[model samples]
Target chain A: MSDEVKDPKDVLICRCEEVTLREIEQAIDEGFDTVNDVKRITRAGMGLCQGRSCSKVIARIIAQRTGKNIEELLQNSYRYPVRPEKFKIFDEEESHE
Target chain B: MGMSTAYYLTLQGKRVLILEAGIFGAGASGACDDMILFQSKKPGINLELAFESLELYHALNVDLKHDLGFENYGGMVLIKDQKELEIMEEFVQQQRMYGLDVVMLDEKEMRKRQPHISSRFIASTYSPMDAQIDPFHVMYGFFHVAKNLGLEYRKKTPVVGIEKQGNGDFRITTQSGEVFEATQVVNAAGTWAGEIAAMVGENVPITPKRGQIIITEKIPMVGETNLWSAEYLVSKLRPEVKTEISEEHKALGLGFAFTRSFGGNYLIGSTREYAGFDTRTTMEGVNAIVKQAVSYIPLLKDIHFIRAIAGLRPSTPDGKMILGEHPDVPGFYTASGHEGDGISLAPITGKLLSDMMCGAPSDSRLEELSPVRFAVVKGEQVQ
Candidate 1:
């Protein structure tokens, strides 16, 4: 909430995708307004871990850059199998037949 | 829908083989919030189809002999403000026109029905037709019965290619190089229907509208009926209507829908984002869902959201489903693009498609649902 200019490049924004603050800032500068928008353009929150690990960090960076509350930023919806599961589970269940 | 179609097809003494691109219920069918509520439908054919589907759900467990974990505990739509309450007044009238048994409840009556609902709600609507089921179990039951009746289903066998044979039959190939020739090919591919149609040289306008849901850890029951916000009705039924809150919520694609699973866990959702195929969850989506849920049910603030998942509702340009045969492709038919209503409309879709394939009297609804409704053959405007 302070006006002190800090280096956005020094920090990591999305740990899941290994996206840095500099990349996130560049994504914002390129006209990505929302968190989901930045994630799509820069792959900041899209990763194997499903963004649960680093989405908040990315949101905060966007909130700071946009001078808006983090609540105003849009979040990407999570996809299925919240964690990784084997595809063989699909085949394994059929063996019950 | 595919499994149910197989069940009906087998009953009509036809050889049926189901080729699933993934495990059963792995798509929208599995990821739904288990709302079989008639209150959600718009009036006219939509409500009539929903009422018909409700009747089918009543008989599905007995017919399948699978129990299905079905429950008719009823449901409620929470109205947060006067604007949303006004919308519900008209929505309830439309539902009533279709003979739905629903009653509007003020804060006192609503509180009597579900005391845990936050005091912010001015009114609510309750309906007995609103119910819940384990979506996976429903498909599994259909598959189990259809299988016993000599139906063959192959999971993970996606249709990689669909070539029209000279004899007017279709040769379907899987990703693993397995091939089979069929007299007719049904495309019940759900959200992937667009891609499947492309394989057969057809274009179906299906957008993967991503919806996110959160499952809280199981606990003692908080309310007796499934609860959704009137905001949800506006979002689903009338997204173009704008207000200050609705406009703000639209940015996050947040609509408040919540239901308790049969196991006592709360399944809270859901955000409608046109994010293409990216189903991964975002921090803002989760936060907005939590904020919407806790705003209506303050008690949920303490609950732990143990799991989060998303499903792509196979949305069409218009809200109606895409069904029936390809106009140009002789043996190719489609039964996909049910969107959020896939779970509710599955039985009806299956029965309808089966009747058409059996050369029986096609349900009048097929006239509207046919894939040619998009009219790519005539090279006309796409709906």
Candidate 2:
């Protein structure tokens, strides 16, 4: 929203996946209206942070462009393993036959 | 499944209305890997239909005018030991005889192709015909084109009832009390298709088989081709090998499938368990997949997985999809129960079902996949 930011396209919205603002805008223009749709098309919210870092930013962008409410757009589904846990943590016991 | 069916039907100049129980790509279609695998298929109608389906995907990429993220990166089946190697050897030969471009790769050749693979794998099979397409892209591609061609769809509108009138017409009632009347109906609800058929007094025998997959952050390519384990394939092809698997692994229905998405994220999967309709990924399932994957490709342990997701695949008893008109329920059709093969066979299934509806003569081989097979097995009349 600020003109001080030089070339918003070059700015990275999703640091984990390194998706640029331009990529997110392009996905929206291509008719991917929903936040989840944009995430699926462009790898914006599908990284290590799991969209916690960029989903709101992307939702705001969708609202500004599509005139849809940001509240409605931010209804992205959350999955299991709330945080980044190691695979070894879940490997407790193995019963080999 | 519903999207593809709608696309084909609309392309044939028929007015189509899609009643969705949820948003776009909300079910298994959204949560699945982008694999249109060929090597994993059994050597039968399943394999034959996959070849045709691959051809259709190529055409759909052009017809839809959108990048479906179609890629022919090929696939590999890692053979862990001599037992799996022996079984895969015969499997590959049979698939080759059926005109598949598949071959067994010795350890030397396999390592040359996939240097990152662990030394535990003795050999592998390679097929140049194996491919992948983004599920979201494909589903939305069909939807976009079909919508422009007069296909109307309502999201979050679940069908509550389906009744047949005396004059061979269908009355479809939605959960919102909205009623729709059509001359024909297609139960393409995937996992819930059995419930849809039951409304009309037909038994489709579709069960929800849950599969879980984990997604890693963007990483370098692990191998030249998408990967699968002959361990699971062998077990599926020869169920007698179940005794060799551990109880935990058996309960998890563990297998190895690692495919990279167009976005550079490696989607490592999965488990095949009958957990009814629950689509929640468990710690046990995710851990098993991670252990199996790390053991196969040690480099994977360093990658950070971002998310875990689960989907319920509509599995049938015979391990084949039901795709035809219900002989007892006239003017009604069922195109469900693809299990894991739904992504691979979506295009062909839609085309065949639409062709059948339009009175176009279809491949006689499809008769084996008909819903009537269930009835005939029950000693009912053939026609």
CA lDDT, every model vs. true structure: 0.77, 0.87
**What tens-digit string does per-residue lDDT give for candidate 2 at B1-383?**
88998999998999999998987788889889889998888789999999999999989999899899988888899988998898999999999999999999999999988999998889999998888999988988898899899999787799999989988899999999999999999999899887888888788888888899998877888779888989888988888864367889988889899898978888899999989899889978888888988888887766678789999999998999999998888778999999999899999999999999988977799999999877544545323
Clashing pairs in 2: none
DockQ, each predicted model: 0.03, 0.42
Error of 2 at A21 (Å): 7.3
Which residue runs does candidate 1 get wrong by more than 4 Å? A1-97, B235-241, B246-248, B378-383
Best by lDDT: 2
**Candidate 1 lDDT, A4-84, residue by residue in tens:** 437757566676556777878876764455766566455565454556777777778778888878876646555445664
Model 1: per-residue lDDT, tens digit, B1-383? 78878888987888999888865566787667887768888876667777777778788879999767787778898887887888888899878877999989888988988998777778899997787787766876787678778998776678899899888888989999999999998888888888888887788889898898877765687778888778767756666767556565686677788887755667889988888888677766776777777777777666666567788999888888888888888778888777778777888878878888888876775688788877574665434
True contacts kept of each: 0.04, 0.42
Q: What TM-score applies to chain A of candidate 1?
A: 0.73
Interface RMSD of 1: 15.0
lDDT tens per residue, model 2, A1-97? 5646588688899988788889888878866778788887776777778889688999999999999998998865676667665554444444431
